[model samples]
Target chain A: MRATTIHGPFDMRVEDVPDPVVQEATDAVVRVLRACICGSDLWAYRGESARQPGQRIGHEFLGVVEETGSDVSGFRPGDLVVAPFVWSDGSCEYCREGLHTSCPRGGFWGSVGSDGGQGEAVRVPFADGTLVRLPADAVSDDRLLTALLALSDVMGTGHHAALGAGVAPGTTVAVVGDGAVGLCGVLAARRLGAERIIALGRHRARTDIARAFGATDVVAERGEAAEAAVRELTGGQGAHAVIEAVGTEQSMRTAVAITRDGGAIGYVGVPHGSGTGLDLSTMFDRNIALHGGVAPVRAYIPELLTDVLDGTIDPSPVFDLTVGLDSVPYGYEAMDGRTALKVLVKP
Target chain B: MRATTIHGPFDMRVEDVPDPVVQEATDAVVRVLRACICGSDLWAYRGESARQPGQRIGHEFLGVVEETGSDVSGFRPGDLVVAPFVWSDGSCEYCREGLHTSCPRGGFWGSVGSDGGQGEAVRVPFADGTLVRLPADAVSDDRLLTALLALSDVMGTGHHAALGAGVAPGTTVAVVGDGAVGLCGVLAARRLGAERIIALGRHRARTDIARAFGATDVVAERGEAAEAAVRELTGGQGAHAVIEAVGTEQSMRTAVAITRDGGAIGYVGVPHGSGTGLDLSTMFDRNIALHGGVAPVRAYIPELLTDVLDGTIDPSPVFDLTVGLDSVPYGYEAMDGRTALKVLVKP
Candidate 1:
């Protein structure tokens, strides 16, 4: 089997690796159909995050179940499925509450001892809890396939941001990023009936996609200017809800600044650089609600998958570039160099 | 007229001052019926907060309207009323949203340009916006008067904590303080139908009030141990909501730690010392929601007033000591020395 691995900073390669096997009663082996490089993954590629040589990388994928362990009852061999970024036991307290990312027994894929998603084949633990099945007739269309692949991570994450920020009918929203997840946030807000959607991004290509995804306004400014633009568009009051898809100090501050008193900021970006420091005085003064973390993709996948299958939304445009398994290195470079919004890899 | 003035740290005096006059068209003059030393006030009395040698010092009071300018129409002379800690214009966008504290034309009482609530007579700006009328029939009872006074700040702040944390039927709540506001939070949580309430306080007197106010459990431990106790009580899952009434780093951290994943922490304490710094990594991983700031007392006063008038709750018990206007300096001492939970002053 060929799998993606990182040797060091700026070093990505596809090399021969042993095929995964079902090793536990709740485990299943999957043959990867599609995988992609995540914005978070670029942290390591750009030397911003530490990673040892030969480390498995990638945590988003869709595949076909090749083998199932005896304890896996909901899924069987040859079934098309999408797996969330984290695997968990479905019965835990957190999982029962639909917070699977915080499940006590859950773990992220491609971390320390787990197999990465960007491989020809991989072993999945708690198979029934981590994987959502697709309709048998659905897998034949490449366009729908691309959309389904997104439900594994990015789309679900964007939905989380909208939900966390309390985006609802007749409200104005500001989305603070142009990445795949941010664009998906715009789509989610629109689907939820937000009266107005503002996308804050400078890139022409990404802003165009943002508009197509339902952004009613696009602010190409950064920092204070971006906040000023949002306030101007909101009649000088600021947006009712803000989606922070980029986890930087400036992005968080901007999100907070452009949110009206009693409004909420839903932030899903993985924190990088100097960690977030909130001014308690300001948050208290305005009564702002800040909510978001890692998305519970497993909990949201079922509903989002239905939307994808019904053609209610098509998020495949986010995958602007695609390549074969052997070109995984190029896929990483495309995303890191800002030439591709997201890269899809076929295995 | 006479008023309470701070001459220096540990030096409070009731001295002669000029009588308040209706200066602005939107202003009204009120004769103080009662005033109380607030927990926040102790910070200045103890020299923890900086203050000038002679500054008007109180901000919580209920009074009778003595006079009103031509523009003040909703209030009449001799009518009893309660004022929120801050005064606002009532027509700004923030005020329209019920966030009066952040109103564009608002300012806090006792600041340089405003008259403090402790004086014999004080001028209130934007009277219609800052004051809520009391039922004429209910002002004759001392007990009811004390409870009404609580609505000006502490009790309303506690209600904000519960509301901010999304407290409702069947949720387990943990309150992290033993001050008047924290005890009021216990009462508010119970009033809101929280199934279980855990109070984190060590003082016996305050713990008794917590129990009377509806705390089902009390933990005397601080820091990690307090968090451990909450987890143990909740079967290692943590509370569904936490109310943080002490604005310290340790209290905030404990509140965050004991909140279950997907839970919320409502904090209303005026942050003192170093500002709160949240670890975005941990908060993101747990999906904790942080919501709260200064209580929007005016927004909640009506409903809370009805509760007080109907005998559904009696917040007056928190006023454990009483003193005349001349003894306000002693009232500050008693609270600063922990000799009194709260002190009510009659002018």
Candidate 2:
């Protein structure tokens, strides 16, 4: 089988790797049908996030089950399914509380000694607990497939940001970031019934998508100007809900600054810098609520999936470019170069 | 008139000051009937928090309105009233959102050039916004008057903590700090129907009050031991809601550590140390929500006043010592020396 592998910074390649097989009673073998590159993957590509030489490297995918172990009762061969970025035991206390990312027994895909999702096949542990089955007849629809594939990460993550920030009917939301996750956050806030959605991004193409995703206003400024623009748009009160999808110190600061007193910030961006740059004193003085982390996408996938299937939201717009297994390296380069909002790979 | 004033660190004095009179159309002159020393005041007493020499000091008090300006519509002469720590215009956007502490026009009591609560009289700005009227009959009951005084700060502050942490029926709550606010937090959680309340404090006397206020368990441990005990109490899942009433870095850390995944920590303690010491990375990975700040006690006073008047709660137990106006300096010493949990002052 061929899989995406990294040998160093800015180096990606598709090479022959041993095929995955069900190794435990709770495991299942999934033959990849569709997978995509995540913004987080760019960290490893740029050597910003630590990665071993020649390690498997993706965490979002959807595929058909090719084989199942004895204890996998919920899925069988030929079933179409989606896998969340992390795998966890279904019955754990944290999982029951809908915080799958905190499950002690859970592990991430593409970690050392594990199979990556950007491959021909993946050995999924806790199959019954991790995979959500999809309707088989819809595989012929490419648009629906892309939207469904988004449920593996971005869409659900955006939902996490919205839920964390307490987005609700008649609330005003400001999303800071122009990436696929931020665009999806705009969509999620809209789905949650936020009356006013403000997208703070400088990119025209991305902001266009944001507008389509229910952003009622767009602020193309950065830093203090961006915060000022957002505040101005919201009548100097800032947004009731601020979604911080860019995990930089400045972005976090902007998120806090533009949040109204008694409002909340739902941050889903993977922190990349040295410090969070969170001014607790300022946040304290403003009565701002800060909530979010590695999003528990699995907990949100079911609802988002229902919305996707019903055509209530079309997250497929995020996948502006597509590639095949052989061009997986190009996909990484495209995402890292900002040439693609998100690259869809049909394996 | 006489008022409590700070001469220097560890030096408090009750000195002669000009009697207050209604100065603004929105102002009212309150004759101090009851005033109390707060834990936060000790910050200035210990010189940890900056204060100008000879500055007036107290923030919590209840009094009788001696006079009202022409524009003061909500209060009049002879009316019994309780003043929240801060004065606000009441109609600002932040105040309307129940975030009076963030009101743009608001100012703290005893701040430089302002009249302190621990005085014979105070010219309260925005009388309609800062003071909640009490029944005329409240003066006859010492215990009820003490509880009403608590409403001006601790009780309402504790209620803010519980509300911020999202405490609800069937939720398990943990309170850090054995101070008046933390004890009131235990009572607030009980009022909100929390199924199990864990009180963390080392003081025997305070812990007894915690039990009486509905603490189901008491953990006298600090730091790691405290976290371990809380986890054990909740089957290693931590508490659903954590109230952090101590402003030190360790107290915030403990609140975060003992919070269950997907749970929240409501911190009302004024951050005393140089840095918050919050590990955002850890909080992010664990999905812990942090919400709180200087409590909007003014917004909560009306609700709490009802409970105080009806005998539903008695926060007066926090007042372990009593002193008269001339003895205000000694009251500060008692609270600073830890001999008093809180001190009630009569002028």
Candidate 3:
């Protein structure tokens, strides 16, 4: 089977690898249909994150179950499914609390002994807990397929940001960033009935999609100007919720500055550059609530999948470019060069 | 008029000061009956925070309205009242949203032009917004006077911690300090119907008071051991809510560790050592919600005052020692040396 592997910084290759097999009683072997390159993956490609040569990569994919262990009672071969980025035993306390990312028995894809999602066939642990089955006819629809693929990570993550920020009917939300997650945050805020959604982005193509994702306004500004633009839009009080999808110090600071007193800042960006140090005095003075971490994608996938299936949302457009499995490197390049908002790889 | 002044670190003195006068149309002059030495005030006394010579010191007080400006309609002469630690205009958007501490026109007591609450008579800005009038009988009841004093800062701050952590019936709460505020947190959590309240303290007197305040258990451990004890108490899952009342990095880290995945850590400690920096990766991985700042005492005073008036709560016990204005320096010394859990001063 052909799988994506990283040899070093800016080095990605499709190479022959052994097909995955269900080795554990709770495992299932999934044949990949679609996989997407994540923005987080770029960290390693850009030498920001340490990666061992020949390490398997990618954690977002949708596929058909090719085989299942005896203990996997809820799923069987030939069923189409979407697996969350992290696999967990659904019965753990954390999982029961809908925080699967913190599940005691869960692990991320591509971690030691697990198969990466960007491969022809991958073994999934805790199959019954990790995979959500989709209707048979749904797999035949290309649009729904792409949207369902997003539910595996990006869409679920964006939804987590909105939920963490306490976005609700009639609340105003400001989404910071023009990346796929940020655009999805705009969509999530709209779906949650936010009265106003402001997208802070500098890029024309991304901002256009942000508008399509239900951003009520777009501010192509950075730093203090971006914060001022949001405050201006919100009657000088700032938004009730601010979604921080870019995890840089400046972006985090901006998120805090533009959130209304007593409002929340939901940050889902993997922190880069410096350690996440907040201005405690400011946060304390304003009583701003900071909530968000890795999205519990497994907890949110089912609901987002419903939205995708019903055509209530079409997050598929975030995948601005598509390529074959052999061209996975090109997908990475397109995303890295800013030519593609997100890249979809069909296996 | 007499007031408490800080000449320098460890240099508190009771000295003659000019009588307060109502200068603004919205101002009032209040004759302070009771003022308390707060744990935070010790920061300046201990040289942890900078203090200018002859600076007025206190911010927590209960008193009788001595005089009011023409526009101060909500308060009248001789009416007993409690003033929040911070004064606000009550009309700003932040104030309207119940975040009076962040009101644009508000300022902390004893800051520059503002009169300190520790004086015999002090001018209060935004009288209509800052002073909550109690029944005249409250002035005669020493117990009620003390409890009402707590409403100015400590008790309200503890309540804010519980509220920020989302404490409710059936939730387990761990309070990470044994100070007046932390003990008040135990009381607040119980008042909110928390199923189990764990008070983390080693002092016999404070722990006894914690039990009296409804702490179901006491964990006499610090740092990792404290977190371990909390986890063990909650069946290795940690508490649903943790109140971080001590602002040290270790205390904050313990609060985060003892909070269950997806739980909240409400911290009210005035951050002292390096800026409040959290392990964002850990917080993110666990989906921990960090919420808290200065308690919006004005927002909570009304409801908490009802609890005091009805005899449903008696927070006066937190003021274990009482002294007169002449002994204000002794009050600071007692608290500084941990000889008293809290000090009450009568002007």
Candidate 4:
């Protein structure tokens, strides 16, 4: 089998790698049907992350189960599934409390303890707790190709931001970026009953997608202009909720500044640590509630999968470009160069 | 009338100033029965604040209504009242939303547009909003003093912390800081139905007060030890709610650390600008919610006043020392030297 290996900054190549088989009783082996590059993957591509050399990189995917260990009961061969970026045991104390991101016994792929999904076949630990089975029989190519693949990572992440920010019915929400995750935030806010969804996007194509995802308004401004535009749309009262999908200082500040005095702000972007200078006083004075962390993607995947199945949300549209496992390097480059919003790779 | 004036950082003076009278249609003149030094006042006293020179310097007091403008109807001459430190007009959108501290036309005493309360007589603006009328008949002793004087600010602030933190019955609560506000937090937590109250206090006297105010456990450690102590008391789950009463980095971190995942951390102290560097990743990862500010003190005074009148909670023990209005400078020195947790000056 061939795997996408990270050699150095902006240097990736597909190399022949040993195939994976289930090692744990609760594990399963999946044949990758689709996998893709995430925005966070660019962090490593740019040498901005602590990822070591030669590691397989992808975490978002739709795969078909090829084999399962004896202890794996709920899933079997030939079933299509979506697994969250992080694997969890689903029974730990943290998992019980829905903090699956901090699951004690669970290990994240591509970072520590296990090989990631950026290859032809990958071992999935905690299969029962982590994998969401797709609806039987009607897994259409278009449905499988939907932006729902992003739900395995980015879309789930955007939902985390929306939930953490307390987006609810009648709330006005401002999303800070137009990336896939941010576009998903616009969708998540719509699903969560947001009345007014504003997407701050500079990209025309992505902004149009955001509108389709339920953004009632779109602002092409950044930083102060973006904040001012949001405030103006909100009648100078500021948004009731803000989802900060960009990890830059300007995005974070816009998230805070565009929120009302007692509103909520949630950030899910993997921050670059560039904007370390947060005005703690201003946030403090506003009495706003701040809550977010890396998304417990596994915890949200089931609901998102259901939405994908019912055709309530078409997350598959984000896969505007597709390539083969041999072209994973090109996929990364295209996304890094903004030539593609997302790239789906067929193994 | 005599007043406590902020000359500069580390410089304060007791001087004769012109007696105040109703200056606005919504203002009232109060003959201060007692004025006190507050922990927040120390910010200006130490010259760390941007307060200008020669300004009246206090925000907590019990006083008698001396006169009122033609439009001030709810308050009249001879009424004993507890004044909200943050004066509001009770009509602004923010005020209507129960955010009197952020009211556009409102003012916080001795900090920005309003005069301080540390004097014989202070002008209490927005009388209908700032002054909470006390019961007509009162026994003029320690209990009445505790209920009236302390409830004027610190007690209300403590309630704000518990409320902002969303404390409810049977919730485990951790309070950081040993000042009057922290002690009041303990009391407020009890009033809000907390089943377990762990107070982190370094001072024996303050800890004793915390215990008296219904803290179930007291930890004498400042930083890590205090957090450990609270975690131990909580059976390693950490507190469901955390009330932060100290503005230093250590206190903020300790407060953030001891709060359980998916918990609320509310802070009420005047923040120092050293930048404690909030772990946004940690905040996001834990799903912890942070809500705080200067305390919408004005918004809460009415309910607290009713509690004080009904003998539900006594907060007067915080007034550990008292002196005449002429001794305002000494009161500041006493609080600065740690000789008095709070100082009340009578007109």
Candidate 5:
């Protein structure tokens, strides 16, 4: 088997690696069917994350079960399934409370957890809690390309933003960022009954996709000007809810600044330290509700899984490009170079 | 009439000033029964609030309705009342939504609104929504000194903390301040069914007041040590709700860091942006809810009017001293010197 590895600044390699085997009784081995480079992956590619080199990279995948340990249940060899980026025990109190990301035994799929998901095959612990079954038969390459892959992280994240920000009927929502995840947020806001959806984007392609995903308007302005555009669209009151998809300082500030007084702002950007210099004084005066952090992707994947299966949501368009696993490194480079919104790697 | 006025840094004057009159059609005249110097008043006294010379300096007052403008209703010339620092119309959409502070016609008592409350007679606008009627008869001087005057701001702000933080039964609440507002927060938390209250304060008097109000423990520690103390008391999980009464960056950080994952932090402090940088990144990873700004004192005063009338939540002890309106300048200096928790001035 081959695995994608990040070995320092601007360096990515697809090299032959040992095939993963079930390491725990609750583990299952899965042969990767599809995986993708994430918007967040670009952070480490840019050497912005605390992530170290020589680590297995990638955390989103749809796969076929190859084998299962004794304690693993609900999954068997040859089963088609998707897994969330974070794995949880599923039975813990926190998991029961639908906060799987905060589950005591939960950890990430790549650098911060047991192992990475970039390889052709990998061991998935807590299989019952982590894997979601597909339609019994294998999905088509195109249908499964984006939706199943998105189920692993981005779609759930977008839903997390909409739900956390309390977007409801007639709500005016502003989505910050034009990435695949942000586009999905536009879709989520529309599905969640947002009366107005504005996507702030600098790229025409991304803005078109955002409009396709339900963005009612797109602002080409940047920084304070972009925020002013949002405010202007909102009648100088700001959006009722803002989905902060970008974690940079300016984006976070824009997210806060473009929300109306007593409005809610949900942010899922994996932010750096500089974004912390927010002014609570301004937040206090506005009576705004800031409710968000990292999206609890695992907790929301099940319902989103149903939505995808039932045809209520099609988040698959986030993957604008799909390629064989051999091109995984180029996919990372393309993402880093902003040539692709997101890349799906069929391992 | 005599009043307290700021001449310069540490320079306060007890001098005669023109008595207030209804300058607007919606205004009413209140003959001050008692006015108190607030912790925030000391900011101007210490020159931290950028005070201009000879500005009337107070905001907390309880008074009698001596006169009403032609448009004013709901009270007669003899009705005793407690005036919310902010005067709202109670008719606007924002007021209807319970955000009276942001109401279009609302007015703050001192720095940003119609008039200051430290004088012998204060003219209040939006008369119908700004004043909560007292009991039919006159109340005691001590009760007026503590409960009603303190309720004008600090006590109500403490209540804002508990309400914004969503404190409830079985909750472990951490209050980040030992000021009168923090002490009142302990009382508010207990009233809201918080099972454990932790007060972070080094002052002996404040620590005692906090315990008297319902705090189970007091942690004199600051910053990380204070967070550690809160975690130690909550089985290493931190408090379910954190109330930040001090608006400095340190208290904001303490409140954010001391809350459990998924907890709510209500900060009512008039924030000085220098503390903890209002770091939203750390807040993101924790999934904390930051809800607070200026207290909607007008919103709460009606219900609290009943509480004060019935002697249910005694806030009178917050006033450590009382002086006539002529001694208000002394009150400001005493409070600025930390020799007074709160100073009440009788007209």
Candidate 6:
């Protein structure tokens, strides 16, 4: 089998690797049909986030079950399913609370010994808890497949951001970042019935996708100007809910600045730079709530899946480029270079 | 008229001042019957917070309405009332949303030329918005008067903390700090039907008050030991809700550390000192939600007042020392010296 491996900075290779096998009673071998490059992967690609040489990479994938261990009851051979970025034991307290990311028995894909999602096959632990089965009829549709693939991470993450921000009917929301996650957040807010969605992004291509995702206004500005634009759009009060998907200090500051008093910020961007630029005194004075983290996408998958299947939201637009398994390195480069919003890899 | 004035650090004096009168259409003059030295006032006393010489001090007070301006409709001259620490225009959007602390037209009680609560009389702005009326019969009872005074700030602030942390029936809550607001938080959590309350404090007197207010457990250890003790008490899962009533960086860090994954921290200590020690990465990885700020006490006074009037809660225990008009300076010294948990002033 061929799989993606990281060999130091900017060195991604598609090389022959042993096929994954179900080794634990709770595990299942999945033949990945779809996977994608994630923005977080860029950190390691740029030598910014430490990575062991020749380590597996990628954490999002949807596939067909090839083999299952004795204890795997929820899935079987030929079952179509999608795996959340992290695997969890569904019965743990955290998992029961819908925070699968904190599941004690859970671990991220591509961690030291785990199989990466960008590979041809993945040995999924806690299979029954980690995989959500998709309908057989939908597997044949490429568009639906792309949308379903997003459920593995971006879509569910967007939903988590919306839930964190308390987006509801009649809410005015502002989303920071033009990445796939931010675009999906706009869709999530709209699906949750937010009356107004303001997207802050300088990229026209990404902003167009944001508008398609239900952004009523776009602020193609940065820093203070962006804050001013959002406040102006919101009648000088700022947005009721702000989604911070960039994870940079400035982006976090913009989220804070553009949040109305008593508003909330749902931040899902992986913190990579200097601390999130938060002034506790200001947050205190304004009564702003800060929530979100590595999103518990598994908890939100079921409901978001229903919407995706019903044509209520089409998040497939976030995947602007596609590549084959051999071109996985190029996919990473394109996303890192901002040439692609997200890259879909068909194995 | 006599009022408590700060000539400089450690220089609190009872001096002759002009009597308060209705100064605006929304103003009402309040004759101070009960005022208390707050933990926050110590900041100005210690010269930590900036203050002008001879500035009027104190913000928590309950009294009889002495006079009402032409447009003051909700209050009458004889009405007994408790004024929240800050006055707000109830008609503002933020005020309507129950975030009076962020009300654009609101102002703190002792700012610049405003009358302080520890005075013979106060010309309260936005009379209808800032004050909550108490039953006429209760004013004569010393105990009831003390409890009503607590509603003017501490009790209401505590309620804000509980609400911000999403306190609900069966929640396990932890309150950080042993001051009046923290003690009141323990009571507020209990009133909200929290099944278990863990209070983190070092002082015996304050912890005793906390226990009486419904804390089921007490952790006297500080720093890492306190975190370990709390985690141990919660079966290593930490508290479901944490109230950070001490605004120090250490207290905020402890609040974050003891919060269970997906838990929340509601902080109401007026942030002092350096930045709140927050690691965005930790908060993000744990999915911890941070909420709260300077409490919008005016919005919570009504509900807390109902509880106070019904004898359902008595926060007056926080007032361990009492002083008359001329001894207001002694009250500040007592609180600053830690000889008094809180001091009640009669003028």
Candidate 2 ranges with C-alpha deviation above 4 Å: none
Q: Per-residue alpha-carbon lDDT of model 1 for B1-347, expressed as tens digits? A: 99998877899989998899999999999999989999989888878778787789899999899899899989999899999898889988788888998888898888875678777878999999999999776668888999999999988999999998889999999999899999999999999999999999999999999999999999999888998999999999788889989888778888888998888989887777314445667779899888888988988899999999898877887899999999898999999999999999999
Per-candidate alpha-carbon RMSD to the true structure: 1.8, 1.7, 1.5, 2.1, 2.1, 1.2
Q: lDDT at B198 for candidate 3?
A: 96
The CAPRI quality class of candidate 5 comes to medium
Candidate 1 chain A, which ten residues in sequence have the lowest lDDT sum?
A273-282
- Greater lDDT among 4 and 6 belongs to 6
Q: Indicate the residue-level lDDT of B226 in model 3.
A: 83
> Which stretch of 10 consecutive residues in model 2 chain A shows the poorest summed lDDT?
A271-280
Taking chain A of model 6 alone, its TM-score versus the true chain A equals 0.99
Provide DockQ values for all models, in the order shown. Answer: 0.71, 0.62, 0.75, 0.56, 0.61, 0.76
What is the C-alpha lDDT profile of model 3 across A131-246, one tens digit per residue?
99989887788888898899989999999999999999999999987899999999999999999999999899898899899998999888889888889998898888999898
Residues A1-347, candidate 2, lDDT per residue (tens digit)?
99999899999989999989889999999999999999999989999888999899899999999999999999999999999999998888888978899888898999998999999999999999899999997689989999999999999989999988889999999999899999999999999999999999888999999999999999999999998898888889899999999788898999999998889999898886513567778888889899988898888888888999999999999999999999999998899889899999998
Would you list the clashing residue pairs of candidate 5? A284-B293, B146-B316, B249-B275
Q: In model 1, where do residues sit more than 4 Å from their true spots?
A: A273-277, B7-11, B46-53, B273-277
Q: Which stretches of candidate 4 lie above 4 Å from their native place? A: A274-277, B139-141, B234-237
| lDDT, model 5 | 0.82
Taking all chains together, each candidate's TM-score versus the true structure is 0.97, 0.97, 0.97, 0.95, 0.95, 0.98
Model 5 misplaced stretches (Cα beyond 4 Å) = A273-277, B138-141, B274-277
Tens digits of per-residue lDDT, candidate 3, B258-346, equal 98888999888888642444777788878888899999999999999999899877788899999999898998899999999999989
Best by TM-score: 6
Question: For each predicted model, how many residue pairs clash, with residues at least 3 apart or on different chains?
Answer: 1, 0, 0, 12, 3, 1
lDDT of 1 by residue, A129-243 (tens): 8888988766788988889999988999999999988899999999998999999999999988999999999999999999998999999999888989999998887888899
Interface RMSD, candidates in the order listed: 1.9, 1.9, 1.7, 2.3, 2.1, 1.5
Candidate 1's displacement at residue B38, Å, is 1.6
Residues B1-347, candidate 2: write the lDDT tens digits.
Answer: 99989988999998999888878899999999999999999889999988888999899999999999999999888999999999999999888978899898999999998899999999899999889999999999998899899998999999999998889999999999899999999999999999999999889999999999999999999999999999999999899999999888899889989998888999899887413557677778888888888899999998888888888988889999999999988888888788899999999
Q: lDDT scores for all predictions?
A: 0.89, 0.91, 0.89, 0.82, 0.82, 0.91
